[model samples]
Target: MISAGQASAWPKFAHILGHDEWIDMPEFQRVEDRVKNRVLLDPMIAEETSKFEKNVLLERLAEAKIAAAPVMTVADVANDPHFRDERSMYTEVTHPQLGPVRITNQAVKMSETNPYVRGCAPLLGEHNDEVYQSLGFTPEEISAWREKGVI
Candidate 1:
């Protein structure tokens, strides 16, 4: 989310970010050019982020008033009160093979219909007969294919 407007602030926080090369990087004329520079930027940012503990880096960013958020893991998201309790952004379901699994809920709410994950994803080829039948294939043909190992 860096922008041309943040150009001034970059130099101030460059020491905290562990890189002075940001000031030397070329000005980007287009989105593609900025994206192309990720080869140089990504490693630098990753290196800098690794030097500090997560909370320490976050505190530094907060002190600098940087608009940044931690990239949370699934367990972290599940435990966060805002996402789990307030927003109800996740739900748990029983996976046939994996047992209980926590899955994300629909972000968008609809007035007329309630969208939700009814079950875990189907196993491979679980709906083969139903799919082929809908496509005008008969039970006999589908069963024959299964018998002949064509499916």
Candidate 2:
């Protein structure tokens, strides 16, 4: 993968990336199959575990800054270099049961007030009691609501 900083300094990276090997999908022929069901069958059955059409090396697209890293899943975002660095977009929060947990930091910046993640994303019925308490429901009432499947 080409690092962002390197390619940002050189515009030639864009020209090179446009002509890379995996840019276009490999040619394939589709067959019409009908018996029990009608479906298009792929004659180009994949021998490689990886498929060319869906599995381009995102890390090799140097000019596009977003493509500098290997493909990251949703769960991988927290650990990605740009997200998890010293100056991070994610922060550590101590959840009551989950212990130290990661959560996304707020995107807004303000001088008068600030935005931040307060705790772990709540589990089912986790913050129900707290919300009920704020709404002036007693603990007993909150418990009754839980039993009644109100939350």
Candidate 3:
């Protein structure tokens, strides 16, 4: 647990990393001692407490909202201006191996433009020659580096 005075200096301390300020902090000593004691005594209790809290929150939320709740259609969501105008929903990128990859604009929209991947994953060193050449390295230099296990 951090003290009030020490917690107040967190922003200032975070900015001065790799300097002597971190070594001079009073909170650092207290935190280190607390961690050491916890590691030595009842480590399982700390692990169980975290899992218990997560389960409790999830159980409460599940009870509040039915597991078989009605699903919303794309039409229902698209009526909202925020979902309709989102730029991420329509963005697409071209991969050298995969051709054009269609990125989903909306998670809920299941349509033709948002089809699953049509190409296989790229093989190892698929663009090694092209990339090295683009970086102004000659073919002979790339071959030498490859032989020496550098590339």
Candidate 4:
């Protein structure tokens, strides 16, 4: 997302000049350079940079007067003209535990059926008994393993 400073500066300049002032900002040039460096020049730079390093880079970019777009939400995606035809992008599923859950179908649109969740996440060691039984272990053997801190 664009920094608060960039958002503030652009609007203020635009208001004063009665037109977009971002066209003349050196910060804009820095932003273009940063994007070009990250995306066009070396896309892998993003993977190389850690979260902390990325934040630091962004801070440096802000200091150099670069701007960015704000983060978009699901509503924004649904309303966007480019994605409007992809209405199946948003779908609802019946989760066994959570009841009706909204899931994104952005992956495969050809399938008309909504995805279904089998169940909630398993609790730690909840299936120990069942799994051990499936492996042909008797109740006594399972109890012995648990007592010996092996299970």
Number of clashing residue pairs in every model? 0, 0, 1, 0
The candidate scoring highest on TM-score is 1
Error of 4 at 116 (Å): 1.0
| Candidate 1 backbone collisions, by pair | none
User: Can you write out model 1's per-residue Cα lDDT over 1-151, one digit (the tens) per residue?
Assistant: 3222254456545656766666666733234544677676667667877888888877777777776678888889889999888777888899888999988888777779978878888989888889999999999999899899898
Summing lDDT over every window of 10 consecutive residues in candidate 2, give the lowest-scoring window. 28-37
TM-score of each: 0.61, 0.39, 0.27, 0.36
**Candidate 2 residue 42 C-alpha distance from true site, Å:** 16
**lDDT of candidate 4 over 15-124, digit per residue (tens):** 32233444354544354543444444243322332333445655644664656443468798777665555455555666656687665555544567755444445667
Score candidate 3 by TM-score against the native. Answer: 0.27
Worst ten-residue run, lDDT, model 1?
1-10
Q: Rate the local accuracy (lDDT) of all candidates.
A: 0.73, 0.50, 0.49, 0.54
Q: Which segments of candidate 2 are over 4 A away from where they belong?
A: 1-71, 74-76, 109-113, 127-151
Residue range 1-151, candidate 3, lDDT tens digits: 1111233343332222222343354534354543555444235433433454454534543443423222347775545456556533444567676778654444555555654444445679888899999999999999999899998
Name the lDDT of candidate 2: 0.50
lDDT of 3 at 130: 96
Alpha-carbon runs more than 4 Å astray in model 4: 1-19, 25-112
Error of 1 at 109 (Å): 4.1
lDDT of 2 by residue, 1-151 (tens): 3332232322333234342332222321111111112222122122221333333535334324444445568878766686677446887899888798767787665779977777777778777678889999999997787799886
